[model samples]
Target: MRIVVAVSLFFLTSTVFAQTKKPASKAVAGPGQQVYEQYCLTCHQADGGGVPNLNPPLKQTDWVQGDKTRLINVVLKGLQEPIEINGETFDNVMPAHDFLSDKEISDVLTFIRSSFGNKAEPVSVEEVKKVRAAK
Candidate 1:
Protein backbone atom coordinates (compact mmCIF):
# COMPACT_ATOMS: atom_id res chain seq x y z
CA MET A 1 0.00 0.00 0.00
CA ARG A 2 2.86 2.44 0.87
CA ILE A 3 4.64 1.73 -2.39
CA VAL A 4 1.44 2.30 -4.38
CA VAL A 5 0.74 5.59 -2.57
CA ALA A 6 4.29 6.82 -3.15
CA VAL A 7 4.09 6.02 -6.86
CA SER A 8 0.70 7.72 -7.11
CA LEU A 9 1.98 10.86 -5.34
CA PHE A 10 5.09 10.99 -7.50
CA PHE A 11 3.12 10.74 -10.73
CA LEU A 12 0.54 13.28 -9.50
CA THR A 13 3.26 15.78 -8.56
CA SER A 14 5.13 15.24 -11.79
CA THR A 15 1.98 15.70 -13.88
CA VAL A 16 1.08 18.85 -11.95
CA PHE A 17 4.51 20.35 -12.50
CA ALA A 18 4.43 19.52 -16.16
CA GLN A 19 0.96 20.97 -16.56
CA THR A 20 1.84 24.12 -14.60
CA LYS A 21 4.98 24.89 -16.55
CA LYS A 22 4.63 28.13 -18.44
CA PRO A 23 6.61 29.77 -21.23
CA ALA A 24 8.76 32.75 -20.34
CA SER A 25 7.30 36.14 -21.24
CA LYS A 26 8.92 37.81 -24.26
CA ALA A 27 7.30 41.22 -23.88
CA VAL A 28 9.60 42.71 -21.28
CA ALA A 29 9.03 46.45 -20.80
CA GLY A 30 11.91 48.84 -21.61
CA PRO A 31 13.46 51.22 -19.09
CA GLY A 32 11.50 54.20 -20.39
CA GLN A 33 8.27 52.24 -20.21
CA GLN A 34 9.16 51.21 -16.69
CA VAL A 35 9.67 54.83 -15.63
CA TYR A 36 6.42 55.93 -17.24
CA GLU A 37 4.49 53.12 -15.52
CA GLN A 38 6.04 54.02 -12.17
CA TYR A 39 5.42 57.79 -12.25
CA CYS A 40 3.50 59.25 -15.20
CA LEU A 41 0.89 56.49 -15.50
CA THR A 42 -1.08 57.86 -12.55
CA CYS A 43 -2.10 61.26 -13.95
CA HIS A 44 -1.56 60.74 -17.66
CA GLN A 45 -3.05 57.24 -17.56
CA ALA A 46 -1.86 54.19 -19.45
CA ASP A 47 -3.54 55.42 -22.64
CA GLY A 48 -2.17 58.99 -22.24
CA GLY A 49 -5.68 60.36 -21.92
CA GLY A 50 -5.52 62.41 -18.74
CA VAL A 51 -8.44 63.05 -16.42
CA PRO A 52 -11.00 65.43 -17.93
CA ASN A 53 -10.56 69.10 -16.84
CA LEU A 54 -7.81 68.08 -14.47
CA ASN A 55 -4.59 66.63 -15.87
CA PRO A 56 -4.19 67.27 -19.58
CA PRO A 57 -4.10 64.40 -22.02
CA LEU A 58 -0.77 63.67 -23.64
CA LYS A 59 -2.16 62.22 -26.85
CA GLN A 60 -0.67 64.02 -29.85
CA THR A 61 -0.49 67.24 -27.84
CA ASP A 62 2.08 69.87 -28.81
CA TRP A 63 3.37 69.77 -25.25
CA VAL A 64 4.65 66.22 -25.72
CA GLN A 65 5.87 66.69 -29.29
CA GLY A 66 6.77 70.35 -29.27
CA ASP A 67 9.97 72.23 -28.38
CA LYS A 68 12.32 70.07 -26.33
CA THR A 69 13.58 72.86 -24.10
CA ARG A 70 10.12 74.02 -23.12
CA LEU A 71 8.96 70.49 -22.46
CA ILE A 72 12.02 69.75 -20.35
CA ASN A 73 11.51 72.92 -18.36
CA VAL A 74 7.90 71.94 -17.75
CA VAL A 75 9.10 68.75 -16.10
CA LEU A 76 11.79 70.46 -14.03
CA LYS A 77 9.92 73.62 -13.00
CA GLY A 78 6.31 72.36 -12.94
CA LEU A 79 3.34 74.33 -14.20
CA GLN A 80 0.94 76.12 -11.85
CA GLU A 81 -1.08 78.16 -14.28
CA PRO A 82 -4.06 76.92 -16.21
CA ILE A 83 -2.90 75.82 -19.66
CA GLU A 84 -4.71 75.08 -22.88
CA ILE A 85 -3.80 72.19 -25.13
CA ASN A 86 -5.73 71.21 -28.24
CA GLY A 87 -8.35 73.78 -27.23
CA GLU A 88 -8.90 72.04 -23.89
CA THR A 89 -8.00 73.93 -20.70
CA PHE A 90 -6.40 72.06 -17.81
CA ASP A 91 -6.01 73.86 -14.49
CA ASN A 92 -4.43 71.22 -12.32
CA VAL A 93 -1.16 71.87 -10.50
CA MET A 94 1.71 69.81 -11.77
CA PRO A 95 4.30 69.45 -9.04
CA ALA A 96 7.97 69.78 -9.91
CA HIS A 97 9.81 66.49 -10.39
CA ASP A 98 13.24 68.00 -10.07
CA PHE A 99 14.37 65.22 -7.79
CA LEU A 100 14.41 62.76 -10.69
CA SER A 101 17.86 62.41 -12.21
CA ASP A 102 18.71 63.81 -15.62
CA LYS A 103 18.63 60.34 -17.12
CA GLU A 104 15.29 59.57 -15.52
CA ILE A 105 13.83 62.82 -16.82
CA SER A 106 15.29 62.20 -20.23
CA ASP A 107 14.05 58.63 -20.35
CA VAL A 108 10.56 59.61 -19.22
CA LEU A 109 10.39 62.49 -21.69
CA THR A 110 11.64 60.36 -24.50
CA PHE A 111 9.10 57.73 -23.61
CA ILE A 112 6.31 60.32 -23.65
CA ARG A 113 7.45 61.88 -26.92
CA SER A 114 7.63 58.52 -28.63
CA SER A 115 4.55 57.04 -27.07
CA PHE A 116 0.98 58.43 -27.29
CA GLY A 117 1.18 58.76 -31.11
CA ASN A 118 3.70 61.61 -30.86
CA LYS A 119 6.61 61.61 -33.31
CA ALA A 120 9.06 63.84 -31.50
CA GLU A 121 12.80 63.42 -31.22
CA PRO A 122 14.32 61.66 -28.26
CA VAL A 123 15.51 63.75 -25.29
CA SER A 124 19.12 63.02 -24.40
CA VAL A 125 20.51 63.07 -20.89
CA GLU A 126 22.74 65.98 -21.91
CA GLU A 127 19.70 67.99 -22.95
CA VAL A 128 18.00 67.35 -19.62
CA LYS A 129 21.18 68.39 -17.77
CA LYS A 130 21.34 71.60 -19.77
CA VAL A 131 17.71 72.42 -19.05
CA ARG A 132 18.09 71.57 -15.36
CA ALA A 133 21.23 73.71 -15.16
CA ALA A 134 19.44 76.67 -16.76
CA LYS A 135 16.84 76.45 -13.98
Candidate 2:
Protein backbone atom coordinates (compact mmCIF):
# COMPACT_ATOMS: atom_id res chain seq x y z
CA MET A 1 0.00 0.00 0.00
CA ARG A 2 2.87 2.43 0.83
CA ILE A 3 4.58 1.69 -2.52
CA VAL A 4 1.31 2.33 -4.35
CA VAL A 5 0.86 5.68 -2.53
CA ALA A 6 4.38 6.79 -3.45
CA VAL A 7 3.81 5.90 -7.10
CA SER A 8 0.56 7.88 -7.11
CA LEU A 9 2.29 10.93 -5.62
CA PHE A 10 5.06 10.75 -8.22
CA PHE A 11 2.54 10.59 -11.03
CA LEU A 12 0.63 13.56 -9.62
CA THR A 13 3.79 15.65 -9.37
CA SER A 14 4.80 14.67 -12.89
CA THR A 15 1.40 15.64 -14.24
CA VAL A 16 1.61 19.01 -12.49
CA PHE A 17 5.01 19.72 -13.98
CA ALA A 18 3.83 18.72 -17.43
CA GLN A 19 0.83 21.06 -17.16
CA THR A 20 2.91 24.05 -16.01
CA LYS A 21 5.36 25.44 -18.56
CA LYS A 22 6.60 28.95 -19.28
CA PRO A 23 5.74 30.55 -22.59
CA ALA A 24 8.62 32.16 -24.44
CA SER A 25 8.69 35.96 -24.63
CA LYS A 26 9.42 37.91 -27.79
CA ALA A 27 12.60 39.86 -28.58
CA VAL A 28 14.35 41.62 -25.72
CA ALA A 29 13.63 45.32 -25.01
CA GLY A 30 16.37 45.62 -22.39
CA PRO A 31 16.45 48.30 -19.66
CA GLY A 32 15.50 50.97 -22.18
CA GLN A 33 11.85 50.00 -22.05
CA GLN A 34 11.89 49.93 -18.25
CA VAL A 35 13.54 53.35 -18.02
CA TYR A 36 11.18 54.75 -20.62
CA GLU A 37 8.15 53.39 -18.81
CA GLN A 38 9.34 54.74 -15.48
CA TYR A 39 10.53 58.16 -16.66
CA CYS A 40 9.46 59.07 -20.21
CA LEU A 41 6.01 57.51 -20.43
CA THR A 42 4.23 60.28 -18.50
CA CYS A 43 5.32 62.97 -20.97
CA HIS A 44 6.32 61.18 -24.18
CA GLN A 45 3.35 58.86 -23.92
CA ALA A 46 3.46 55.15 -24.83
CA ASP A 47 3.18 55.94 -28.55
CA GLY A 48 6.30 58.14 -28.51
CA GLY A 49 4.39 61.27 -29.39
CA GLY A 50 4.99 64.31 -27.21
CA VAL A 51 2.19 66.35 -25.65
CA PRO A 52 1.80 68.85 -28.51
CA ASN A 53 4.39 71.56 -27.87
CA LEU A 54 5.39 70.24 -24.48
CA ASN A 55 7.21 67.01 -25.25
CA PRO A 56 8.53 65.88 -28.64
CA PRO A 57 7.68 62.75 -30.55
CA LEU A 58 10.44 60.22 -31.00
CA LYS A 59 8.75 58.47 -33.86
CA GLN A 60 10.72 59.14 -37.05
CA THR A 61 12.21 62.29 -35.59
CA ASP A 62 15.33 63.54 -37.37
CA TRP A 63 17.15 64.06 -34.11
CA VAL A 64 16.34 60.58 -32.87
CA GLN A 65 17.14 58.85 -36.14
CA GLY A 66 19.78 61.09 -37.65
CA ASP A 67 22.94 60.69 -35.58
CA LYS A 68 24.03 58.20 -32.96
CA THR A 69 26.22 60.71 -31.14
CA ARG A 70 23.39 63.19 -30.89
CA LEU A 71 21.07 60.60 -29.38
CA ILE A 72 23.68 59.38 -26.90
CA ASN A 73 24.48 62.93 -25.85
CA VAL A 74 20.82 63.67 -25.34
CA VAL A 75 20.51 60.64 -23.08
CA LEU A 76 23.70 61.21 -21.13
CA LYS A 77 23.69 65.02 -20.77
CA GLY A 78 20.00 65.84 -21.18
CA LEU A 79 18.63 68.12 -23.88
CA GLN A 80 18.07 71.72 -22.92
CA GLU A 81 17.83 72.88 -26.51
CA PRO A 82 14.44 73.22 -28.13
CA ILE A 83 13.69 70.26 -30.37
CA GLU A 84 11.26 70.10 -33.26
CA ILE A 85 8.95 67.15 -33.56
CA ASN A 86 6.15 66.49 -36.05
CA GLY A 87 6.25 70.17 -37.11
CA GLU A 88 6.12 71.48 -33.52
CA THR A 89 8.82 72.87 -31.26
CA PHE A 90 9.33 71.64 -27.68
CA ASP A 91 11.63 73.63 -25.42
CA ASN A 92 11.09 71.53 -22.33
CA VAL A 93 14.02 70.63 -20.14
CA MET A 94 14.66 66.89 -20.37
CA PRO A 95 16.43 65.99 -17.16
CA ALA A 96 19.62 64.03 -17.69
CA HIS A 97 19.39 60.32 -17.01
CA ASP A 98 23.15 60.01 -16.58
CA PHE A 99 22.64 58.37 -13.25
CA LEU A 100 21.42 55.18 -14.91
CA SER A 101 23.85 52.30 -15.27
CA ASP A 102 25.48 51.64 -18.64
CA LYS A 103 23.45 48.47 -19.17
CA GLU A 104 20.22 50.23 -18.23
CA ILE A 105 20.95 53.15 -20.54
CA SER A 106 21.95 50.80 -23.33
CA ASP A 107 18.76 48.81 -23.05
CA VAL A 108 16.61 51.91 -22.95
CA LEU A 109 18.43 53.43 -25.89
CA THR A 110 18.13 50.20 -27.86
CA PHE A 111 14.40 50.08 -27.15
CA ILE A 112 13.96 53.66 -28.33
CA ARG A 113 16.02 53.03 -31.43
CA SER A 114 13.86 50.12 -32.52
CA SER A 115 10.45 51.29 -31.37
CA PHE A 116 8.00 53.92 -32.78
CA GLY A 117 8.84 53.21 -36.43
CA ASN A 118 12.31 54.51 -35.69
CA LYS A 119 14.35 51.51 -36.67
CA ALA A 120 18.03 52.09 -36.01
CA GLU A 121 21.13 50.43 -34.69
CA PRO A 122 21.08 48.97 -31.21
CA VAL A 123 22.88 50.89 -28.49
CA SER A 124 25.22 48.77 -26.39
CA VAL A 125 26.37 49.21 -22.78
CA GLU A 126 29.91 49.39 -24.03
CA GLU A 127 28.97 52.33 -26.24
CA VAL A 128 27.21 54.03 -23.36
CA LYS A 129 30.17 53.44 -21.07
CA LYS A 130 32.50 54.80 -23.72
CA VAL A 131 30.41 57.96 -24.01
CA ARG A 132 30.24 58.35 -20.23
CA ALA A 133 33.95 57.79 -19.83
CA ALA A 134 34.64 60.58 -22.31
CA LYS A 135 32.99 63.17 -20.03
Candidate 3:
Protein backbone atom coordinates (compact mmCIF):
# COMPACT_ATOMS: atom_id res chain seq x y z
CA MET A 1 0.00 0.00 0.00
CA ARG A 2 2.85 2.44 0.88
CA ILE A 3 4.62 1.67 -2.41
CA VAL A 4 1.40 2.35 -4.32
CA VAL A 5 0.95 5.71 -2.58
CA ALA A 6 4.57 6.66 -3.27
CA VAL A 7 4.21 5.81 -6.95
CA SER A 8 0.94 7.78 -7.17
CA LEU A 9 2.58 10.82 -5.48
CA PHE A 10 5.58 10.61 -7.79
CA PHE A 11 3.33 10.53 -10.87
CA LEU A 12 1.23 13.43 -9.59
CA THR A 13 4.33 15.55 -8.83
CA SER A 14 5.80 14.78 -12.23
CA THR A 15 2.51 15.72 -13.92
CA VAL A 16 2.31 18.97 -11.99
CA PHE A 17 5.91 19.90 -12.86
CA ALA A 18 5.35 19.09 -16.50
CA GLN A 19 2.19 21.22 -16.59
CA THR A 20 4.00 24.17 -14.98
CA LYS A 21 6.85 24.22 -17.51
CA LYS A 22 6.77 27.24 -19.81
CA PRO A 23 7.10 26.97 -23.52
CA ALA A 24 10.34 28.19 -25.14
CA SER A 25 10.15 31.59 -26.77
CA LYS A 26 10.64 31.85 -30.51
CA ALA A 27 12.07 35.29 -31.34
CA VAL A 28 13.16 35.38 -34.91
CA ALA A 29 14.24 38.42 -36.94
CA GLY A 30 13.03 38.59 -40.53
CA PRO A 31 15.32 39.14 -43.50
CA GLY A 32 14.27 42.75 -43.80
CA GLN A 33 14.88 43.36 -40.10
CA GLN A 34 18.37 41.90 -40.41
CA VAL A 35 19.22 44.22 -43.29
CA TYR A 36 17.83 47.23 -41.45
CA GLU A 37 19.93 46.41 -38.39
CA GLN A 38 23.05 46.03 -40.48
CA TYR A 39 22.71 49.18 -42.57
CA CYS A 40 20.08 51.68 -41.44
CA LEU A 41 20.00 51.12 -37.70
CA THR A 42 22.99 53.42 -37.12
CA CYS A 43 21.40 56.63 -38.38
CA HIS A 44 17.71 55.77 -38.22
CA GLN A 45 18.14 54.09 -34.82
CA ALA A 46 16.64 50.81 -33.61
CA ASP A 47 13.19 52.41 -33.20
CA GLY A 48 13.56 54.54 -36.36
CA GLY A 49 14.13 57.74 -34.41
CA GLY A 50 16.94 59.67 -36.08
CA VAL A 51 19.26 62.11 -34.41
CA PRO A 52 17.69 65.49 -33.62
CA ASN A 53 19.61 67.61 -36.12
CA LEU A 54 21.66 65.04 -37.97
CA ASN A 55 19.50 62.25 -39.32
CA PRO A 56 15.76 62.45 -39.94
CA PRO A 57 13.26 60.26 -38.17
CA LEU A 58 11.48 57.51 -40.12
CA LYS A 59 8.31 57.67 -38.04
CA GLN A 60 5.04 58.62 -39.77
CA THR A 61 6.92 60.71 -42.32
CA ASP A 62 6.08 61.39 -45.95
CA TRP A 63 9.56 60.35 -46.97
CA VAL A 64 8.94 56.85 -45.61
CA GLN A 65 5.21 56.51 -46.35
CA GLY A 66 4.79 58.63 -49.46
CA ASP A 67 5.75 57.95 -53.08
CA LYS A 68 7.56 54.67 -53.63
CA THR A 69 9.83 55.75 -56.46
CA ARG A 70 11.19 58.74 -54.57
CA LEU A 71 11.92 56.57 -51.57
CA ILE A 72 13.68 54.01 -53.76
CA ASN A 73 15.76 56.70 -55.37
CA VAL A 74 16.82 57.95 -51.98
CA VAL A 75 18.47 54.59 -51.31
CA LEU A 76 19.70 53.93 -54.83
CA LYS A 77 21.05 57.40 -55.68
CA GLY A 78 21.44 58.93 -52.22
CA LEU A 79 20.23 62.34 -51.09
CA GLN A 80 22.50 65.41 -50.94
CA GLU A 81 19.92 68.17 -50.69
CA PRO A 82 18.22 69.15 -47.47
CA ILE A 83 14.95 67.38 -46.74
CA GLU A 84 12.15 67.95 -44.28
CA ILE A 85 10.71 65.19 -42.14
CA ASN A 86 8.16 65.36 -39.32
CA GLY A 87 8.23 69.18 -39.38
CA GLU A 88 12.05 69.22 -39.07
CA THR A 89 14.58 70.03 -41.77
CA PHE A 90 17.52 67.66 -42.20
CA ASP A 91 20.29 68.70 -44.54
CA ASN A 92 22.65 65.87 -43.76
CA VAL A 93 24.01 63.96 -46.71
CA MET A 94 22.69 60.41 -46.86
CA PRO A 95 25.32 58.55 -48.85
CA ALA A 96 24.06 56.27 -51.60
CA HIS A 97 23.34 52.67 -50.61
CA ASP A 98 23.56 51.60 -54.23
CA PHE A 99 26.06 48.94 -53.27
CA LEU A 100 23.27 46.88 -51.68
CA SER A 101 21.61 44.33 -53.92
CA ASP A 102 18.16 45.05 -55.32
CA LYS A 103 16.62 42.51 -52.98
CA GLU A 104 18.42 43.95 -49.99
CA ILE A 105 17.30 47.45 -50.84
CA SER A 106 13.75 46.24 -51.32
CA ASP A 107 13.77 44.36 -48.06
CA VAL A 108 15.20 47.28 -46.10
CA LEU A 109 12.77 49.72 -47.64
CA THR A 110 9.85 47.37 -47.09
CA PHE A 111 10.90 46.98 -43.47
CA ILE A 112 11.06 50.75 -43.03
CA ARG A 113 7.73 51.32 -44.76
CA SER A 114 5.94 48.80 -42.57
CA SER A 115 7.77 49.59 -39.35
CA PHE A 116 8.08 52.73 -37.13
CA GLY A 117 4.30 53.15 -37.00
CA ASN A 118 4.13 53.70 -40.75
CA LYS A 119 1.54 51.61 -42.56
CA ALA A 120 2.67 51.57 -46.17
CA GLU A 121 2.88 49.00 -48.92
CA PRO A 122 5.90 46.71 -49.13
CA VAL A 123 8.62 47.55 -51.63
CA SER A 124 9.06 44.69 -54.06
CA VAL A 125 12.34 43.46 -55.52
CA GLU A 126 11.04 44.23 -58.99
CA GLU A 127 10.42 47.81 -57.91
CA VAL A 128 13.97 48.08 -56.59
CA LYS A 129 15.34 46.60 -59.80
CA LYS A 130 13.38 49.05 -61.90
CA VAL A 131 14.57 51.98 -59.81
CA ARG A 132 18.17 50.80 -59.93
CA ALA A 133 17.94 50.24 -63.66
CA ALA A 134 16.56 53.70 -64.16
CA LYS A 135 19.33 55.27 -62.07
Candidate 4:
Protein backbone atom coordinates (compact mmCIF):
# COMPACT_ATOMS: atom_id res chain seq x y z
CA MET A 1 0.00 0.00 0.00
CA ARG A 2 2.85 2.43 0.86
CA ILE A 3 4.67 1.55 -2.38
CA VAL A 4 1.50 2.18 -4.37
CA VAL A 5 1.02 5.60 -2.70
CA ALA A 6 4.66 6.49 -3.35
CA VAL A 7 4.33 5.53 -7.02
CA SER A 8 1.15 7.55 -7.35
CA LEU A 9 2.78 10.57 -5.75
CA PHE A 10 5.80 10.26 -8.04
CA PHE A 11 3.61 10.05 -11.12
CA LEU A 12 1.55 13.03 -9.96
CA THR A 13 4.64 15.09 -9.31
CA SER A 14 6.16 14.07 -12.64
CA THR A 15 3.00 15.03 -14.50
CA VAL A 16 2.82 18.38 -12.76
CA PHE A 17 6.46 19.07 -13.49
CA ALA A 18 6.06 18.10 -17.10
CA GLN A 19 3.16 20.49 -17.51
CA THR A 20 5.08 23.29 -15.84
CA LYS A 21 8.18 22.60 -17.90
CA LYS A 22 6.43 23.05 -21.21
CA PRO A 23 7.29 26.31 -22.92
CA ALA A 24 4.55 28.87 -23.43
CA SER A 25 3.24 29.47 -26.95
CA LYS A 26 3.70 33.23 -26.76
CA ALA A 27 7.26 32.81 -25.58
CA VAL A 28 8.08 30.88 -28.72
CA ALA A 29 6.57 33.54 -30.99
CA GLY A 30 9.25 36.13 -31.65
CA PRO A 31 8.40 39.82 -32.12
CA GLY A 32 7.10 39.57 -35.68
CA GLN A 33 5.41 36.19 -35.57
CA GLN A 34 1.95 37.68 -35.08
CA VAL A 35 2.35 39.97 -38.08
CA TYR A 36 3.78 37.11 -40.10
CA GLU A 37 0.77 35.00 -39.14
CA GLN A 38 -1.64 37.77 -40.03
CA TYR A 39 -0.31 39.00 -43.38
CA CYS A 40 2.43 36.69 -44.60
CA LEU A 41 1.50 33.28 -43.26
CA THR A 42 -0.96 32.43 -46.03
CA CYS A 43 1.51 32.66 -48.89
CA HIS A 44 4.71 32.23 -46.93
CA GLN A 45 3.20 29.56 -44.68
CA ALA A 46 3.84 29.28 -40.96
CA ASP A 47 7.24 27.71 -41.64
CA GLY A 48 8.23 30.31 -44.28
CA GLY A 49 8.13 27.58 -46.89
CA GLY A 50 6.39 29.45 -49.70
CA VAL A 51 4.10 27.86 -52.29
CA PRO A 52 5.91 25.96 -54.99
CA ASN A 53 6.55 27.93 -58.22
CA LEU A 54 4.26 30.63 -56.93
CA ASN A 55 5.79 32.01 -53.76
CA PRO A 56 9.42 31.73 -52.76
CA PRO A 57 10.58 30.39 -49.43
CA LEU A 58 12.17 32.79 -46.95
CA LYS A 59 14.46 30.30 -45.32
CA GLN A 60 18.14 31.17 -45.65
CA THR A 61 17.54 32.85 -48.97
CA ASP A 62 19.39 35.88 -50.39
CA TRP A 63 16.05 37.67 -50.55
CA VAL A 64 15.82 37.52 -46.79
CA GLN A 65 19.43 37.92 -45.67
CA GLY A 66 21.05 39.80 -48.50
CA ASP A 67 20.80 43.53 -49.23
CA LYS A 68 18.59 45.22 -46.63
CA THR A 69 17.33 47.95 -48.92
CA ARG A 70 16.32 45.48 -51.61
CA LEU A 71 14.50 43.33 -49.11
CA ILE A 72 12.70 46.35 -47.76
CA ASN A 73 11.82 47.44 -51.27
CA VAL A 74 10.37 44.05 -51.98
CA VAL A 75 8.04 44.56 -49.05
CA LEU A 76 7.17 48.15 -49.83
CA LYS A 77 6.90 47.91 -53.61
CA GLY A 78 5.94 44.24 -53.87
CA LEU A 79 7.55 41.57 -55.99
CA GLN A 80 6.54 40.45 -59.47
CA GLU A 81 8.02 38.61 -62.40
CA PRO A 82 10.22 35.56 -62.22
CA ILE A 83 13.04 35.41 -59.69
CA GLU A 84 15.29 32.50 -58.96
CA ILE A 85 15.92 31.53 -55.35
CA ASN A 86 17.75 28.46 -54.19
CA GLY A 87 17.83 27.29 -57.80
CA GLU A 88 14.01 27.48 -57.97
CA THR A 89 12.11 30.11 -59.97
CA PHE A 90 9.12 31.91 -58.50
CA ASP A 91 6.97 33.96 -60.81
CA ASN A 92 4.09 34.96 -58.57
CA VAL A 93 2.97 38.47 -57.74
CA MET A 94 3.46 39.41 -54.11
CA PRO A 95 1.17 42.37 -53.65
CA ALA A 96 2.50 45.44 -51.91
CA HIS A 97 2.31 45.46 -48.14
CA ASP A 98 3.04 49.18 -48.24
CA PHE A 99 -0.03 49.85 -46.19
CA LEU A 100 1.64 48.36 -43.15
CA SER A 101 3.27 50.79 -40.77
CA ASP A 102 7.01 51.17 -40.61
CA LYS A 103 7.06 49.43 -37.27
CA GLU A 104 5.02 46.53 -38.61
CA ILE A 105 7.28 46.13 -41.60
CA SER A 106 10.34 46.43 -39.45
CA ASP A 107 9.12 43.89 -36.97
CA VAL A 108 8.01 41.47 -39.69
CA LEU A 109 11.27 41.81 -41.55
CA THR A 110 13.24 41.47 -38.38
CA PHE A 111 11.27 38.36 -37.53
CA ILE A 112 11.82 36.88 -40.99
CA ARG A 113 15.50 37.67 -40.89
CA SER A 114 15.86 35.82 -37.64
CA SER A 115 13.49 32.93 -38.02
CA PHE A 116 13.00 29.84 -40.28
CA GLY A 117 16.63 28.69 -40.14
CA ASN A 118 17.71 32.26 -40.93
CA LYS A 119 20.21 33.97 -38.71
CA ALA A 120 20.75 37.54 -39.80
CA GLU A 121 20.65 41.11 -38.56
CA PRO A 122 17.26 42.51 -37.60
CA VAL A 123 15.73 45.20 -39.81
CA SER A 124 14.99 48.52 -38.18
CA VAL A 125 12.03 50.85 -38.57
CA GLU A 126 14.35 53.52 -39.91
CA GLU A 127 15.52 51.11 -42.58
CA VAL A 128 11.98 50.36 -43.65
CA LYS A 129 11.16 54.05 -43.59
CA LYS A 130 14.16 54.83 -45.77
CA VAL A 131 13.20 52.16 -48.27
CA ARG A 132 9.63 53.42 -48.37
CA ALA A 133 10.88 56.95 -48.85
CA ALA A 134 13.07 55.85 -51.71
CA LYS A 135 10.05 54.51 -53.56
Compute each candidate's TM-score over C-alphas: 0.78, 0.77, 0.80, 0.80
| Model 1, span 1-135: residue lDDT tens | 999999999999998887666332322466777888998889989989998998999989988898999899888988889899889998888888888889999998988898878888899999999988888
- Candidate 4 lDDT (Cα, 0 to 1): 0.90
What ranges in model 4 sit over 4 Å off? 1-24
Query: 2 or 4, which is superior by TM-score?
Result: 4
Quick one: best lDDT, which candidate? Answer: 4
Cα lDDT, all candidates: 0.87, 0.81, 0.88, 0.90
Residue 135 CA displacement from its true place in model 4, Å: 1.4
Model 3 is weakest, by summed lDDT over 10 consecutive residues, at 20-29
lDDT for each residue of candidate 4 in 1-135, tens digit (9 for 90 to 100): 999999999999999988877766656776688889999999999899998988899999998999999999888889988899999988889999999999999999999999999999999999888888878
For candidate 4, list the clashing residue pairs, or say none: none
> Model 1: how far is 30 from its true place, Å?
1.2
What TM-score would you give candidate 3 relative to the actual structure?
0.80
Error of 1 at 58 (Å): 0.7
Model 4 clashes, total count: 0
Better by lDDT, candidate 4 or 1:
4
